[model samples]
Target: MAIPPDIKDSIAKVKPLSQSAVRLMSIMADPDHTVAQIAAVVESDPILTGNVLRVVNSPAFGLRAKISTVARAVSYTGGNMVVGLALHLCASGIFNNPLDGYESQRGSLWRHCLFTAIASREIARFSDGKADPEVAYTAGLLHDIGKAVMSAPLGDSARKIIAIADKGEMPDFVAGEAKAVGTDHPEVGEAIAIHWSLPGPLREVIRHHHAPSKAKEEYRTLVYAVHLGDFIAMMSGTGTGADTMLYLLDHDYRNFVDISAAELEKVILDAGQEYQQVVESMFGSEEEMQ
Candidate 1:
């Protein structure tokens, strides 16, 4: 599966999502945008509106009243959180499809993305980092999108990559991907993010999540959050797919963020419970293996 140089270059030039994602990113950048304005944009896309409301009423928020509209959900959860959560919901279908050799169910990827998004937000809050929780959430959710895309067109190569990864370890898996597919999932995800016209920060986060040290300060934090969140989810036996065996807990990551082992454990524990409730509410099931 030698990757052609042309394909590699083409992938490098890939754009992000269409106008919808770009518009949402623009609104997110505008601090002056009210909840009503943000909700209006989400409402313009009926599917996004419905998903937002579904998330708001889910156990993740624990709202007592049923949220019938995007506006109320945004108002209830605060604009920043709503924006991040909305993006996750809106894009879920795009990444939720089954992949050969991945071992994830129809919506498993979407569930894992949402889990990481929530966990990343909690980590940022606990770290007291200036990082935007919404941005962190979005970065975490889309971190592995490349794997989804690669699985589609390069199914055989993807299987070989996973096979080699399972036989060795995390770095080995990455190496195998580079050897068999010309690039790893992180790079592929970065390419896809760029193809979709996602924000620069997000594109970088997706590119470097597996190697946070390669990113700049802000992007480094985003990558770290996604890395930690994904590690915790994999350990918890939550929708890690065939890639679960490749999971590695990078101890040095805490050196960049100054979080202790005890603190890390707490974040993972709390996130597990939240993950359960959120998954149950969204998919009507708490059993990840089911």
Candidate 2:
């Protein structure tokens, strides 16, 4: 479905990512780029560098040695996570705001996205090299960004969409959202990805995260990783809004990610803990999120 002209205009006019954030994404897209190169770009931006260090030092990693340099932090945190952190820092305004349309309070979406990122990374580890864990981490981090853009436009229709999904009148919330709004969050997310000139895999993951089966053949594994990561986040109670667990799960994900129930449980438990530490380091305490 074509995004409505109004939403298209909003996307075109949406806040541009910081130059540092854009640079980090560019470096991430380059397979030949070394971690030091990304570290250099990150160190160029003091805020990004400081945030990376903070996340590394957070209880999430439990590193005994304090990471003083951006390079060490980047190496420890993984390049994908540093890129995700840069994106999160640049998009703070969009993420911090409450999604009234989705009935989500402030900070909930950020937590959900962070949880999904960590979970997606863990899921990718079982992909047998079909998916890159770091790339999956970045894709999962950005999978729901379109929701921030779509929230206001969704407005009161959020309830109607939820009702339809709850009653099984629609296949899932994406269908319900498309029925109520001109487009769903994934579609809007693709538009935002285009606006930001994000790489193809990231854009594909964002656009088809709800239906990994529909993504391009090359990106299906990565998209499925994020799709399952989103499911894990929602199941673990880190959902962004009223539509939590309302999306249909594509069971075919097993074809791509070979994880057992026990592994999935472990991923959820570990990701939930990491998500809390990242949130506390970047935003504030868990109590503040509520």
Candidate 3:
């Protein structure tokens, strides 16, 4: 679908997806790249190298790695881990702050998105291996691309539209967004995903995360995973904003993914254990919040 003009203009103002992140994703997607090649890319960029070192020696690793070189970092965690950290560092720019019109403070949207990403990866792990955890992580990270697209145009008016939706006056939250901004976030986000050359399934996750049942058959499980991740983030109070009331739990997911509430609870707790560590490693320390 063509992007709504107002939302497109807003997307225009927002920072484009990082080219370095895009290149890293492309290289990672291909298995032909050797560890040396990946390390060389990180070594050439000081900022990227610093991010790699941070994750390598983070609390998540359970010890002070004290690693000093990009190649050694790559050796410690393998090429795949390096790619993941590089992706995290590169993708942080567009998502590193709270989106105006979508939240009251900076980093709120990013916090919510990170929560969803973490939950999505964990969900994929316990879904009988039906989902790809790596892809799930990427999808969760970018699921709210639409809100970012609307940031500039919607500005502070998100609350007004959200109020209208919360009052049960619209078909759903997306409808409320359409009424206020001339377009909805899901569709706008889908456009951005396609323009970014994301895989078809990832695009579906971005577009149908709020309504997983509407997704195509092949991508339904991935969609459901993101939907649950989104719900978990909302329930956990990560950064729901006005969406707290607008979205509902997707009950139909049980038929596809086999997870009990007890298990789900455990998942959240486990994710919580590493949440701060993961966030600080990817985005930076609490200094980012200030």
For each candidate in the order shown, give its overall lDDT on alpha carbons. Answer: 0.66, 0.86, 0.71
- The residue-level lDDT of candidate 2 at 209 comes to 97
Candidate 3 residues 4-65, lDDT tens each?
A: 67666655555555555666556654536667877887888788788788777776565554
Best by lDDT: 2
Question: What's the C-alpha lDDT at position 33 in model 2?
Answer: 82
Q: In candidate 1, what are the lDDT values of residues 76-115, reduced to their tens digit?
A: 7565454544554555545656766465567667667767
Give the lDDT of residue 89 in candidate 1. Answer: 50
Error of 1 at 152 (Å): 3.8
- Candidate 3: stretches off by over 4 Å: 12-16, 26-44, 58-62, 71-93, 283-287
lDDT of 2 by residue, 1-290 (tens): 99999889888877889998878777766657898899899888988888888888887577898989888888888777777678777887777789998999998888888889899999999999888887888888889989998998888887888777678778888888888887999999999999988889999999999989999999999999999999999999989989898888999999999999999889989998878766676556777654
Error of 2 at 63 (Å): 5.6
**Clash number for each model:** 11, 0, 2
- Tell how far residue 224 is off in model 2, in angstroms: 0.7
How well does candidate 2 score on lDDT at residue 258? Answer: 95
